[model samples]
Target: MSWKQQPAVVSAPPSEDAVRIRTRSGIAAVLFLPALFIAKVLLLATDKGGRCFVDDIACAPFPDTAFGALLVAVVLALVAAMAAPVRVARGALRAQLLLEAAGVLVVLAYP
Candidate 1:
C-alpha cells in the first residue's frame, strides 16, 4: 500500500490520572535516594573505628568506587523518575527500587 493508504496511527496524549501518578512516583523515587544515603551515612558515622553492624550485616563498609557507582545510580534514577508522568514514572521507580535493592543486598552479602 502507498504511504497514505497505510493505516494511520494516532497516539493519545497522557491523561490527568497518568500525570498525577507519575508526579507522585517521581517524587517518591527522588526521596528514596536521599533517604537511603542519609540513613547509610548515619549508620556508618555512628559505627566506631569504621566498623559497622555485626559482620557488617546491617551496614557494610563500601569501597569508594562502589559508593561512587551508587551515587551515580541514584542520580540517574531520580532523573528518570522525574522525566515523565505516572506510567513512565512507575517504570522508572521500579528500576530505581531494583537497583537500590540490589546494591543493598550486595552490601549485606559481604562479611
Candidate 2:
C-alpha cells in the first residue's frame, strides 16, 4: 500500500517506527540465516583423510562427525539463546533447530 493511502487489505501502516523495525528485522533475517548456515557448514564439513586421526586430531566417519557437530551446535545455541534479546533468540534458536534437523538427515544419509 502507498504510505499516504490506506490499503484495502488490513496491513501495518508505514510509520517511521514500523518501517525501522521492519528494516531491522529484514536485515537480521538476511544476515542471521546465512551466518548460522555457514556455522553449521564449518561444524559439519570434514576432510576424508581426516579418515585417519593425525597425532592429536580425532577423525571419525561422516555420521559420527556430523552428530558430534550437531550436538555442539545445539548446546552452543541454547547457551546463546539464554543471553540474547527475546525475539532474536527465538529466531536464532529456531534456525538452529532447523539446521540440526537437516544435519540429522545428512548424517542418516551418509551411509
Q: Pick the candidate with the highest TM-score.
A: 1
Give the alpha carbon lDDT tens digit for every residue of 46-97 in model 1. 5441464445445534665875687588667767766766666677767777
Let me know the TM-score candidate 2 reaches against the reference structure.
0.37
Off by over 4 Å in 2: 1-61
Using all chains and alpha carbons, the TM-scores for the candidates as numbered come to 0.46, 0.37
lDDT of 1: 0.63
Per-residue C-alpha lDDT of model 2 across residues 1-111, encoded as one tens digit per residue: 657876698866455544444454445435644664665454445553323333334544466676677767765665544445556666656655665566545543442
Best by lDDT: 1
| Pairs with backbone N, CA or C atoms under 3 Å apart (clashes), candidate 1 | 21-86, 22-85, 22-86
lDDT of 2: 0.54
